[model samples]
Target: MPTGPAATAPRGDLWRFAALSGVYFAFIGYFNPYLPLWLSELGFGAFTIGALVAVQSATRVVAPYAWAWVADHTGRRIRLLRIASTAACLCGAGLLPTPGWIAPHAGYVGLVLFLMFMNTSAMMPMAEAALAQRVSTERGLDVGRYGRIRVWGSIGFIVTVVAFGFWFDRMGLRWFAPGVVLILFALVLACRQLPADKAADEGAPAAPPLRPVLAQRPVRWFFASAFFMVLAHMSLYAFFSLHLDALGYGRDAVGLLWAVSVVAEIGWFLVQGRWIGHGTLERWLAFACAVAALRFAATAAFGASLTVMLLAQAAHAITFAAHHSVCMAWITRHFPGRLRARGQALYTVLGYGLPGVLGGVAGGALSEAAGYAAVFWAAAAAGALAALAAWRVGQAAHKALSATES
Candidate 1:
């Protein structure tokens, strides 16, 4: 059947969003790879940077779900985007205005934490759930097709991260706050172009807004698995620059290593559907966790060989991205309306929040007390536990899904 004009519009909407994702990603990408580097540049010690990073993660733990709950009840997705993005710009821009105000020596930490709470954390979970819901239930939608659109975010991440690191070395971290503000403004414009969700029509049945998300077993397990995995996953990012710095790598080399990680992220997105075709989603997640276990191990052991470090970075595809895709896919397959958004929020809160907060602090303490080697060892240990958790979750999900069919 030929499509109507309205039906054709969402595909157009997605392309618009693809650009937004790229823009949104580009805004934050510079920091994702190099924030720790920046913290080091500003005469920061490891403990102080870790505390600052930990605060941001702590804010994310509660904030995503709170906003997601508001979105679910009000059915006000795009409105949240405008509010979230605008606030994010101001928050990031605040760093430039209010340096060293939080404490005598530790000001940027407070600034970044406020930014994550106000702006960046809410943007992606809301967008991810909205996009996933559209592609999941909408007739004629092809989910596998998302990879190409999402790849632009990776492209944005790589370009900005690699280039800006060089710029930071030359022009300095003074450029970070202002550069981030410009990129976020671009994201706000992109968000303005998104199609709004139509959940509030009078024809729809009345229901209580913001249904509790923990009612589902699959969701609980998925979030728990995400938490443990991300706890381990973030350790690498929160400290790998420091790890590399200790290992005799320069700022430029660290940027390229970070790029190598995201390149693997893009490659994983490219092959994920096919990779899952060859194995169960459970198998893919388990494989990724297992790779994470090794990736951390390699980070600890292979400080001298940049080649091994580069190869280890490639494991991000399996470790972070693949684990994320599996969780999102599970939500799409298992969750219904409103719950889907809430579930994504829960994932953000728990996955990035608790684990992230703890890992940043723990990775720092571990590095400070023992060394970078010990931090990766602890991260690997977390991954080992995550692998077990993933296997348990998969087995449990398989049984429950089968039981539901019967």
Candidate 2:
């Protein structure tokens, strides 16, 4: 195993990280798209399902930072990753109804999910922090190398989404709990494969204060853009499957739609290195948000048309994959070395956490009241706002650069 930067890391070590990403996202692939459907099958209303799904986001609000603080301070990221994945696997068993297990009542289910998410939610930030340390350079993240490894996540997602779509279609969603447990078990095993290195920062100088970094104008605008961009995505994450199902789409069709988006996402990650350098990360972020607006609008207005939905899903290349790469680049540049873990955690909190809570709950109510289409309309509006914020990020970054140069 290479103990140095990702550039110097052996190919096998990089592949291990790729394997971990693949399995971790494989767990997410089935869980995100199917969890609501499974809950609905258990007779929970849309509002209840939304709230339950929001439990994961709720954990993201505080859990990642808490975990990151420990990782940063102790430099025990891989150890924590293993522990978290093991805990998540154990918590996942609570979802099953073995003899004497509690029934899948709403409260019981929510509690189990909450505990499970508390562990699982922390895994990504820790893992990303570790990986970023390898791939990042003084200039920024090595977009191509990073994308090559990250692309495995999209591959895992698509594989499970499509396969389990067929599985649920044939075997019924009663198997959802078992499937979750199995994936989590896989996650635990993957974590065990990661090389355990000693603390990188032991006896090193103290990291700079975090507050001053947060105070920068470009950072503020960048987070603002992330908030709205993810807020826009919340509609899809929380309700897109339900929306398709409500429109009479079958489980197989719903899964295929999701797979379409992942396919596009995979393609972008595979080639993003070539295109990402053509413009500034901030500019790319703005373009991605603009595409997000258009994507959601199509889903809202023409969701019943498979062709339109497929086209909309294809834009995931830009809206999700590209946007994520840009954000990773920005985070790598803004928060380097000792601050890396917390920076990724903060992105989880502001970018995905708060927005997810709002989008899930509000979207649920909006779907229950006006219909699922209304939620997408609102998401479209949010995407537009994200584009504006990202544009401001570009302006702020340029101004900061000029001031520094002068």
Candidate 3:
């Protein structure tokens, strides 16, 4: 059901792009779970673990836009994507041997800064920017289709996570770094196959200034609500795996729970076209924010149970996937090609960089003091406020679009 980049691509680059995402995200699933796991095994606690993960999210505050500016103005999106991929591979490759040397002597604090932030961090947003070109700019492409191609990433996530869990059970975590390095190299290979965008490259149709469009009220609210949603969701990224591991869950089970969550994300990608087509942007945001509140609350309320945790995480479809598709469509409609990169950068800086950092820091403290339950309850509250912002945003978006049409 999913169209490849080339199908929409003037050159049939659809499958190639899909491969790119699949390989990249596969590496993410392959290694990310082990990041905190490694820290814990090395004798760090929840608070310290949180501090370590912060570097990764904090880097987005600067790097994505910095790289995106180059992609946009330089008309070197493909080349940049390739270079970034190669850099990421090199970074991941470097981490493979560091555990034997720097991890014990130099310490995880340094490695966290290096591995999470410096190496594997910038891969996703840059790749998303290029593949996102396939979506409908104005009306938007069918949302349901994404589930198919995106599912490969989920499959990759599931396979590696489960495999690593089993492998670690028998052998230990030493295998994680090597697996991650291999996956990054796979991504580089995939990037080599992606089709070039002549329009984005040849500088054919330039969109207007991003600053002017972003200056609008609804757009401002759009970002504010998005930031809250990401902030609310950050706890899962911060602590879900650690909590499970502490509760006596095996490595395999931990990976399975994560796999289930991504499956929900995959489902959302598949049906996004059908689901988002029915609602106005404001209503979509409202639903996603409301869902975010409930999901976090559910995690807080019955988090000790694996079933409850899986159910809550599965809400990733509405909370994350739907939220993203709507935001992408909104940007495409309101901003032009020239500034889309900047618009995305603003989205990254506000929604990702600032709130993500806050969420990581606060999640650590909450997990340490109030326990995981209270941490999730606060995230739920953040989602409620985000929903309110979306209500006002919906009203503004409708009014703005009506004015434009009239």
Candidate 4:
């Protein structure tokens, strides 16, 4: 956010931003798939693990916005990123067993996770806002440039998920907390490499109120679609590891399955610019949601078959990578300039936060009562709803465009 020379200087070193993204998501690759497994290793029940995972969602509901608002007003996103990363690293250390100090009890572990997630959750929104400013143009997001940079995150995730998957398999999950701390420490280092500029608009007029933007029909439908799509994905984020484990899949196989999805995701991100422009963003969102429906259904019904599981994982190219690109395009269009950070935060809150909570708590109960297959079935239903909502978003956008051109 630095003015003039300082602001322009960092543009030359885009890899710094890429590095930040890679390291952060690398942490995610391990944490999301393995955290529940670690808790289970510590003798926690499914419902308890679900509730603890919900802690991350609960913080996402408000923390990102709070951090973004401060960054928007102060134009110090990099500084905030450093603070969040450092704080999260510190809190992650609490997960380590230190005699009577850091017990693995539910109350103790839950609090540590809540604080860690609260800080870590803000990183992506702030980083995206900063990166988008660098890569976006008057026409829209520079898909090629953005894709080239963002692909590193996929690379990072794949590396860690596969490596840690094998590591935990060979050794044990007792080392999980230490791995988490190490990754978080790396995130702090990554943040230090980013440019230290503040946005030039620190003294500019206040950003337009967000309510009017929210009132637009297209915007409403867009959020609704995101909500359901991400809600459906919670099955993967919250329970995919446990699901495979329950079915007797080895930890190495679980990691390989996760890596397969990221490989597909990486392929899509590297070449998305070529295909993203072939269809409207809304149309793409609709397609992604439709694929999500199929993907989750396949995951639920045929999870026992390795071939079917591999095919389903491969669909991450469409279900996550493409959907993410389209959503970023939509958000960049809807909230330009000073509004960017808050816009990203709203997406996190509505799309991931609320649905994550519902998915974790409710999916836990459903999985406990009916089994993991039932949870994925419910996710498939959410995906179907998301497809319908995305279609409505396309309709609303077309109608609005027509009104304006007329």
Candidate 5:
């Protein structure tokens, strides 16, 4: 059976992990909120923007698993991560619009976005797997401390969004691509420094097949819940900045608003190790789902109210942080040893990839038909569905335990 780490890591390892985490998510912070704004600035319509986002998400559905399969089979997990990170950094340069000659037409920009996201999509799963494996397979490393190291990513996000938001406030949105390239360059260096997986030192066996892990009932329900939970965020992710801009909130303020949500996410990451131990995973997931429902509803109803918007942003603690912690811990416990990388990839595909694709297409159409607010209303409904799925997950957990006991 799998287990959490039992001992503290050296300060050196902790700092290394923290730095890598920070650099990695710095790229995400830049990409997630601003990409659509950049697209809009380039003259893409709402539906076209959604289509581009959907294309990127569709690639994720294939990319992560393909990359993970390579890592698990080749036993070069860290090596693959480094290559992807480097290539992605190079691709970031393509997003910039050249003056006069090429102003980044829809087809060209969409292709670049697809390739860029595809290369970078597997980095998260690979990084998480590498760190978890490093902690578990080594002595004197505490698995419970993973969140503490990971929290730096949230900090990096805050800095990027706020600083870049401010910069873009003064400058134009055209600088967005250059800013992304700079951060991704830093990320490339960060990826090179991660420790190789000790389990693959030599004589390590290939990962066990994926069917057995997928066969578990809790895993299935968790993914079902997670798919909806992530799907609900599509409105916010694809258009939150645009929504704020449309409402007359300047870019600087929009960046700060994004920062506010991540600040809450950081706090949750700091305390999540303790929080995960307090309740059954099912209960934790259920609460997150319920909070997610309220969060999106608040966004739909009171998005113009700064007080209400901040409050909704704060709820990201439960919606993303708590939900994510539960998912990570569950995977750590069940998908031990050689299964770690593939398992993380599977989780990524289910929780993020599929949701991004479906939600992007649907949210784009809905926002165009009704309004941005309608997208959030639909998000609220998805959250409710996720909560119901979490309830089913809880039931399934109870039944499994009872069967094992009997």
Candidate 6:
């Protein structure tokens, strides 16, 4: 870990950090729900859309680790963050020319978008590393404080989702690209205002070799479990709205369903600090995996029922929020200093990027063959496997803790 001058960094810096975080997630909230719609507006077929989205996930497999390595070696996280924010904003603006410049050329557009999103995708893992460092070292703060700041990101996401849904309904998809550009610029300004970390200036210690870290049994299990858990999410993330529409729900209703899940996730972020101290990390991970199993199973079985859907959506608190918090906590414990960024990148690659690419492709194929219901059932099986992995993690952790006590 890099250590140098430590003075009271202003609380305002933390708040600005929160703002930056919020702006970052707002981009995702808008993109996740709206990107396919925007692509379809350009007359691309479903297969083309799936292929293009896979390009984004494919980039993620390399982009975040590449960016983190540069930041860790150069020790200039904020500078890199600013560059990424600016580039992504410009990319968003480029998509907004009249007559829909990129829309008419779907393959060309996908190529350009793949590059743009790759640049943008590194932001989340980098931001987490930054926040974890500051939260751990700064006075009058702890890991719990990180959640308070992160909740704003969820709030920002909700704001954009609701706002874009309404505007897209009224004015049409033409406004989507420009709206994203405006938000990205706002993110740039927020990034500029973030507090400087002295550790980045002092130079991070050389990270230990990766093989030993991966060789750790807990780390291996966590990654395996995360991969399966995210695989279970493929159907929900990619086709939930279509499933709802197929069952006779309106656009507004679909939006409301998503909002409910996000709201539940936010609630968990706000309250999870209290829960964090109450259980072992392995137990929490197991609980999250179990809930994920239930959440996917419920969606598979009762997706069309409004009441059951609401209840299943509420499990987002456990499925995503609790799972994420425990995973980050585990990483923070295992990987410190220069290693934090790499650890986060590894988590994102296996936990999100790999599953996103594989799951999106597989889910698309399976849904086409068997129906959307089968997709969720497959997701349920993935979640069950994740639960099994988590249980093993818990067993190993409990044995370790017992050995330490003895």
Best candidate (score: TM-score):
2
Comparison by TM-score, 1 against 2, better one:
2
Best by lDDT: 2
Candidate 3 vs candidate 6, TM-score winner: 6
Q: What is the TM-score of each candidate against the true structure?
A: 0.90, 0.97, 0.90, 0.96, 0.94, 0.92
**What CA RMSD would you report for each candidate?**
3.5, 2.5, 3.1, 3.1, 2.4, 3.4
TM-score result, candidate 6: 0.92
Candidate 4 residue lDDT tens string, 1-406: 1111212324556899889889998999978889999999888888898888888888899899999998877788899999999999999998887323565689989888999999999999999998888877667777767788889999999999999999999998888988989999999999998987654756667766788899899999999999999999999999999999999999999999999999999999988878888888899999999999999999999999999999999999999999998888889999888888999999999999999999999988998999999999999999999999999999999999999999
Q: Write the per-residue lDDT of candidate 3 for residues 1-406, one digit (tens) a residue.
A: 1232322544356667678767777776765677778767766777777777666778778877777776677656777777777777776665666557765433545453564454344555555556566644334433554445566676677677777878887798777667766877888888788776556455655434566676788988988898898888777777777767766788888888887877888777776666676778789889999999999898778877877787887888788778887776676566545565666767777888888789878888888897777878999999998999899898887788799999
Worst 10 residues of 2 by lDDT: 1-10
Clashing pairs in 4: 1-197, 1-198, 1-199, 2-197, 2-198
After TM-score superposition, what is the CA distance of residue 187 in candidate 4 from its true location, in Å? 0.5
lDDT, residue 391, model 3? 92
Model 1, range 1-406, lDDT digits (tens) per residue?
0022222336787787788778877865776667777677777888777877677688787778788777666677778888898888776666665344443257545756566455678778788766765555343223355565677788888888799878876787766657767887788788888877664422344324434546656556666777878888777768887888888887788888888888988987776656555666666667788889899888888867988998898888778677767777766665556665677777788888889889988788878999888888888888887787778777877887899999
- How far off is residue 119 in model 5, in Å? 1.2
Ranked by lDDT from best down, the candidates are 2, 4, 5, 6, 1, 3
Candidate 6 lDDT tens digits, 146-230:
6778888888888888877777777888787677778889888988887665664456566556677888777888899999998
List the global CA lDDT of all models.
0.73, 0.91, 0.72, 0.90, 0.81, 0.78
Cα-based RMSD of candidate 2? 2.5
lDDT of 4 at 67: 98
Model 4 TM-score? 0.96
The 10 consecutive residues of candidate 1 with the worst lDDT sum are: 1-10
TM-score, prediction 3: 0.90
